[model samples]
Target chain A: MATNLTGKTIVITGATSGIGLATAEELTRRGAHVIGVGRSVGRCRAAEERLAALNPAARPAFCTADLALQSEVRRLAGEIRGLLAARGPAALDGLVNNAGTFTYWLALTTEGFETQWAVNYLAPFLLTHELLPLLAAAPTARIVTVSSESHAHTSLRWADIQLRRRYNGLLAYQQTKLADILFTAELNRRLRGQAPHVHAFAADPGLVDTPIGQKGTPELVQWVWQRRRDAGIPPAKAAQGIIALLDEGLAPRPDTVYWRHGQPRQPSRQAQDAAAAQRLWALSEQMCGTNNGSLS
Target chain B: MKSYVLITGATGGLGKAFAVECASRGWPLYLTDLRPEPLELLAGALHRTYGVPVRWRACDLTDAGQRTALCEALRSEQARFGGLINVAGGDHEGLFCEQTSAQLRSIVRLNIEATIEMTHALLRLRDASETFRIVNVASLAAFYPMPYKATYAASKRFLLDFSLALRQELAGQGVTVTALCPAGLPTTPACIAAIEAQGVMGQLTTQNTGAAAAGTLDAALAGKAVYIPGLLNRLLRALGGLVPPTVVAWFIGRRWGAARRDLGNPAESSILVPEASPA
Candidate 1:
């Protein structure tokens, strides 16, 4: 775990707290220069200050971006590209698509799409695609997406992807998780064996206690807290799995699915469905407005 | 020549249940699994009970080469394949990092690799104008990352997605691919172990394996991409997803981790594993 990240520049979305913040601290401690992305400037500044205090002034910088909005995510992507261009080629070592929000109530993003799906799926989709050049500029770059096991329940409804007809927050979140795996699989398929080196890996940080769960209510959040406290494994250990994927070169099959505990997890039914992958790819191209090829 | 439904993992708990459901319907059977003795015994019993011809193929499905050879042999036998159900699989109990490479590889090969190969082989044999069915048994664990049974869940998720996509691609091609997502069935060893592992062995009786299989087959034939076996599962599947990944992952990971530890407690085993006769 003691590897030098000294000159390495890392980008992480959702850096305000929980896994994102914890990862920021860990990466900064390991000598990497991290650019923390969060929605609130105050929280971002606070996190940056905390990191500085922990690192004794050797802290990664902070960038404020609301990943829920495509425009904002696009801007963040550009900013990252600019930073890397200035830092020189292969300066960017890793990108963590960790920023996401889930609402018990159905909400819409600035893009007019469902909030959870847009923030969790669409935003990452766009940001990753837009900054691909910067990712490619680097000799070997790693893109670690945080997905979930909840994705098993999600069925891709091509006809009504937004859940406009029948909206359920949980189902929508699962849809996005399923999308994460599909996107990862497609990305790996496109990478064709060149991963972490040429953009490889995505991980699901199996349940850990984090502030993101408290968005609903204090009581609800406490319930979440107690459940996690009762059943929760250490987030640090789960984070180790993400670190493992980044450090230990991904297996021969990056397109193959894995869980945060460093176990090989099955992807959602949709991830393996080639026909659905094809359909989803076409739809995602339309949604993200990019032309990456199909997984078939 | 009578048409036959070939099933893998046909000797175990869920597989045996599926076999009974199919046999009762007068479907000729072609069953395979690693446990040759029990599989053969089940095959003989089913044949005698139903008066339907039964053929048992013994092979480790995780071995791709052996699975290929088995498929070729089945094709050579000119078996009129009507449907193929992939029900054979097992789980490794341990922390993800502690899991041996062989354990992870074996589960992946059996659940994902073997199923994929078997589906392709049988799809190749289906008559152009005749509708054929392929049922890939997946689990509710696939719905999300399992902190405990991580790899097994991910494999099921892959199958769930693969089955749906294949179903769509094969649309109008006379081949239907349906993935069955069953949660907490008490009929098999794996199910019992999973239930015991979760500290909710009593809640394991949500649906019988035979009923779940019939429901899954019905959904597959009707062209539904995925068939979640129970109402409660469908609801939980619908709920508990509104929060962010890190949040849900944290909650689930913690809960499952604790449950895994509980399941590991030898005293809890009595409450977890149900003693049952093979249906």
Candidate 2:
């Protein structure tokens, strides 16, 4: 059954390119009002224009922001709020935290966190926290963060969550992916009692060929990616797995919130560690300086 | 028709100095920053201390809506502004590739975008009868191509060139624009720390913020196009002109890169950007 998302507004970060862009196209094709975010102004404008042209019915608006910065994320929430407010008190129905990055060399946001940590893990955490009110305002809302199967093996170092000392590009990326599922599970747990209608989910976008791996990488990494990309699936296929989480007909399992290819899968033991999720959540609160010990 | 000089980034080190200097001279002020409580405290202190008419409202200048709301508030009040000081600016010190694109965009937004938009808006809001003095807080690095501070320096250079060009464009229309280029002044704790990290070089170039504010204001009032505060800074600017920009960039890259490493985590303290004035 092809359900209509005619009046629903969904906000997706990093919608200008790669899986984010492909997901945006899928959302638009479904007749949803998409509010997309990108870092570069030119790219945002271009993406908005392209999306508009592709689907005349899809009124996709793009906001330019650097999700790596907390201040920018706060501003983005306000901008999205203002955008939705302008459209007759219509609350946001969905939030897709699909923006992820893989940097070979370590970089830092203005907020002094590792770039991958900031963009991949922290951006989603902060953006969701900031936009939770809007999510609650809806009849029912869903929060879908794009996690990875890379989350399976890796574990977060509680001592140095950011890996400030012995930084490895792959390790840092994997740690953030781990943090994503943990964050999603913890956020879902918190929202269950309070705003039960607003559910949280994690999508394991299985190794789609995207430019995320190619950008700002070492020459060796680029050489490997050139060959590795052939084995990966298309971004549109991965996008379906993400969008499936937002489907109303798709009944969720009480025990399984992690989905891949539209099917519930048991995450790693580390991802299922309730105590670890609680610890990571508390630590993230401190790092983000977010006073949302409880839902705002 | 009591007119007031509006200062952006009112709670910052140099911004606070500008506010204090203006108040001491009996210039009524309209201040704006990112936080409300601090603005209230500063306004109260300024009014109590200097016995000057001080008013403040907190605004995030980066947001166009907030800026418009602030301007609309001013317009509703029928407030007049005698001078405008663009003191709200931001910087991120690191290698270009090593910094997030968001940091790079922020430098452009705060340094270039906010300044230009505010100037355009406030110029329309200016009291035509009074001489509207415009002071843009550019840096000494504006003259050169910087490396680790590439984005910041480029933004400042944009301000420098823009201020000069705009000054000419608005010359006979009762507005005089001045670009204040200072080397180093202890404007914020982070700034002071960053300077201290430069060792003897920081000490040699650093000056009093109060004096910089005072001198720059005087220079602006006198219709000077540019004001470099310290004598050493002035001399250094002149001497730096002798070297090729490529060489200057390489030298600065090495020096500032080393200094940045010494400073450790740049943002562990507070947000460096001063959420400057709005309306």
Candidate 3:
């Protein structure tokens, strides 16, 4: 555990399990007060017990919000803001946008966005926007969006970003990862000069052995994932890179915000394409209307 | 004095929808429920969102003394009622012998006693200048004898029969009584889970709280006595009425038993439908 974590408060979505959970545990172990979030109360309660058992003095708490809905995301942001304000400073040191999904079939959330697109991409976008005031209040803050190397395989489908016209589960997932990197780049570019202390970075938690593959997939896909995951590293190892990005004191280079192996790395050509990043931001803003007046 | 539609259970899923629906229709509202905080929150939000005159207080409708206190507060304010939506009812779903005596008593007290007492109290306070409209939320399960939900079904049956009988008495007296016998309402989290546990059938029969509230109001204001929301739910009710109640009980027993297993809280699970001003 690091000695520099005292008095810091972090928020981690999907912190109930997998990489997010590991990151939350690591952060708590270092003496930071963590607010872990899960999709359901039962899951959050279970996660709370596990964290309490590991670090009783950590005094961690969990909140439940369904990330698939933008309404829920906005509400969660407001809730965290209220909670932080009541505590005193109303500042946020870190936000881990790690909650995600992988579904074999195309399903739409109540708001009509594709489930994967809604959970993986839109949630992070809206949540970050909603929490900008709190993030801005911190002397220095970090936003780590968990992207994947799979982002290299695909570019944004501008015609149908939600994939209503054509759908493949793996491809859809890869596209969200691509969108995440693009979003990080766009956000970093926007933050320069205005709020240079609040850096945005994408952490590639490379193929950790977790249950991301088996859920909502066909039996054959599950069988294949079971074999493939046997060779992958544990979530703790993957979580370290994300933690490093969050803990890094210095500001990152604006153009290179993607992190891997605790070092800055360049994303795919499409991810780094400023034109595409701007386009994606505009579309996302249109889809989920911007609540905050400032969105450069 | 201006008349405000008095809604019980103003914080629960269905009750909130009723509050929103009434406010959307420009009806001044007097909302009551168990908790002062949530009641205050919802009332403030409704007044802000819909720009309607929304007044609220906390009252445990099941307690006669509390109900009397609530009426007295209304009386002191010179509150007149042109509408009353009785949405404050609850259920404890499990085997009759398994549920605690207190739980069983709560189902009867809340679903029957509280509703009847509120109805009588509000009838006297109705605004004589405008026609009064009343909607009593019953369940489609009222038509059958359910095995697991024997007590709940019987209570809803009472509301259904009581509403119809009251309608006959109030006919041509510038007041209309409506029985809202909905099959399943996707109002609260627990109810949504229960509906999902039933698979495709649950998905089909269940109605959204906002839409149901709006449509039920439309039907009630048009003087429709019995308004069951969905065509399929109404079909199920009509078809269910043809079968002997004994057979219906066995079928519902098997169906709910399966849903309970899917729910996976085996020791003893109680669900609250969350309507009415049981604050």
lDDT of 1 at A83: 66
Ten contiguous residues minimizing lDDT sum, candidate 1 chain A: A104-113
TM-scores for all candidates: the values are 0.48, 0.54, 0.62
Question: Which tens-of-lDDT digit does each residue in B1-279 have in candidate 2?
Answer: 147888888777778778867876789999988888767766765675456888888888767788888888887877788888999887765467767777777678778887887788789888888899999999988988977667777888899999999999998999999998888665444565666677766756766565677789889989999999778888889999999999998888788777768877465322445321100
- Candidate DockQ values, in order, are 0.01, 0.02, 0.03
What would the per-residue lDDT of candidate 3 be over residues A22-55, giving only the tens digit for each residue?
Answer: 9888888887778898998998998888877777
Compare candidates 2 and 3 on TM-score and give the better one: 3
Stretches of candidate 3 above 4 Å error?
Answer: A1-14, A22-93, A97-134, A137-296, B1-3, B23-27, B48-51, B97-104, B127-131, B171-174, B186-200, B253-279
Residue B263 lDDT (model 3): 81
Model 3 chain B lowest lDDT segment of ten: B270-279
Worst 10 residues of 2 chain B by lDDT: B270-279
Every model: iRMSD = 23.0, 15.0, 10.3
What TM-score should be assigned to candidate 2? 0.54
lDDT of 3 at A203: 87
| CA lDDT of every candidate | 0.69, 0.79, 0.80
Order of all candidates by lDDT, from best down to worst? 3, 2, 1
Which candidate ranks first by DockQ, i.e. highest? Answer: 3
